[model samples]
Target: MNQIIIFDFDGTLADTLDAVVRITNRLSGEFGYLPTNPETLSQIQNLSSWQIIQQSGISLFKLPFLLKRVISELNQDLQLIHLFPTIPEIIQQLQKKNYTLYIITSNSKINVITILSRYNLVNSFKNVYSGISLFGKHKIINQLLNQENIEPQQVIYIGDETRDINAAKQAKIKSIAVSWGYNSAEILLQHHPDALIAHPSELIAVIEQIKNPIG
Candidate 1:
């Protein structure tokens, strides 16, 4: 059975949470957004991205600029970003099982490719769709499906945020929310992803279940 697994790069594939927090905090003063304290971090992890943007006092107009700066800062710190535990092995296993993989991300393509190249995992994904709009990932997912000639039913978009789940839904595909990423389990559960996985190792089992829903 051939399947396509599209992934969100930042929190889903690479553990860039701490670095993002640091960058956002460092720029908070300049951007007029509230800096994330420990409490604020916990609070926002459970909130959707839009909610966070609202609470942080950042206008939608400034989000793109802010994100661009953040991504640029993140680029400078790419050496600090890395795959979550067991991701390499999981990717290998999925490849062995013949799952075609790709990445769709708001992060820059260079950033995604640089990290994959670091781990010698560049060949794992057939292609990458990067630098997507912060709120327009559904369009990218649809484009990827059309470009790849894959049906929504045969594809699953996996990510760590409620927006990702929403995008997958908007694109008419299944979503598996990962708890080990940006969103908390409780928050992700509320989004009602088709499957919610807690660890990288749990991915294979969930994919298998998606492949065979009755079994």
Candidate 2:
């Protein structure tokens, strides 16, 4: 089997943070929360995923319904969204190298696939595990290892959040945190990922070094 590369959808692969903010503000009236402004968003970006949610003033009991509505909203907006810079080319390069790509996202599967299709990237990834809970990515990571009969050493989890680093740690897989995602680089660094990459162009070299480190 090809070496696997698992990705997080929202902030990692798809540049949906801005869209999320817009949607969140739009839903604030119906959901009865304050609109998140850029200043608030900047502060939220320093916190972990779960922490951000807690700060949202949405109780855990109602989070599922809120997420349902958010996912539905995102479904309609996915195509309008874009990937991080140079991501499409990088993914194509990875595909050419025969890496088995998989996506684990809190977003709906249809939403993930829809946007990939827009970029002519639907076939670049082998599978997408969608609708993962905010704090439950480790469980899905474990499930992916089991379901795919994959060895942990042959896999790397690449994502943009502190929670992704935590999940990779829990799953005992190497993690690379991209600086351009949901959390600031400083905050993500505090979480201690195996590596921190600053750009899409740096990814291949970093992965190669990780896979075949020089003595």
Candidate 3:
């Protein structure tokens, strides 16, 4: 069977936590809420803006305005987006192996495209799926499975958070959780992903193992 590999953009392919923290805290200040510290912000890195607000005790009445403002600001700050270390090499290796690659992200389409283009990695992916709504990984994954004619057993989803693992499970695809992203090893391990990778290089070995597993 042919293999397809899908990746989550923000925390998995790019180091976006710094940008997320900056934007979240800026929005919190704008909404008259206490600014979140880096440590606190790190813990909620996997959540969407609405989810973060709810988890952080922000009132529902202020959420809509705050979310809109934050998203607008983030869109304007695209210059700050960056690819994670060694990601280009990883993409090159996967391409060399003839692995079908795609990106399934919660980020808006424009932002995902712009960032990938900026990093010159846009051509590495055969397709990019961006979710219109927050926390839309599951929906995107389902779409890819049906629209792209990819079977669950022939695909692997690589991501940073427990939510990504759950999304892959919901889509019936194998999942690999990366420890170097937003969520720690402990949090990702709780989801019991098919594998866990600590560095970009380890991903190649994981994919090889998946392609040739022992009975």
Q: Supply candidate 3's per-residue lDDT for 207.
A: 82
TM-score for predicted model 3 compared with the true structure: 0.87
- lDDT-better candidate, 1 vs 3: 1
TM-scores, all candidates, are 0.97, 0.95, 0.87
Q: By descending TM-score, how would the candidates be arranged?
A: 1, 2, 3
| Candidate with better TM-score, 1 vs 3 | 1
Candidate achieving the largest TM-score: 1
Winner of 2 and 3 under lDDT: 2
Residues 1-215, candidate 1, lDDT per residue (tens digit)? 47999999989999999999999999999888778888878889998877877788887888899999998999999999999888988888889999999999999999999999978888999999976487899999988989989999999889999999999999999999998878899898898999998888889999889878993
lDDT of each: 0.90, 0.88, 0.81
Q: Pull out the clashing pairs in model 1.
A: none
**Number of backbone-clashing residue pairs for each candidate, in the order shown:** 0, 0, 0
Ranking by lDDT: 1, 2, 3
| Poorly placed runs, candidate 2 (over 4 Å) | none
Between candidates 1 and 2, name the one with more favorable TM-score. 1
lDDT of 3 by residue, 111-186 (tens): 7778888768889898998764445678889898899898889899999887888888888889999988777787
Q: Residue pairs in steric clash, candidate 2?
A: none
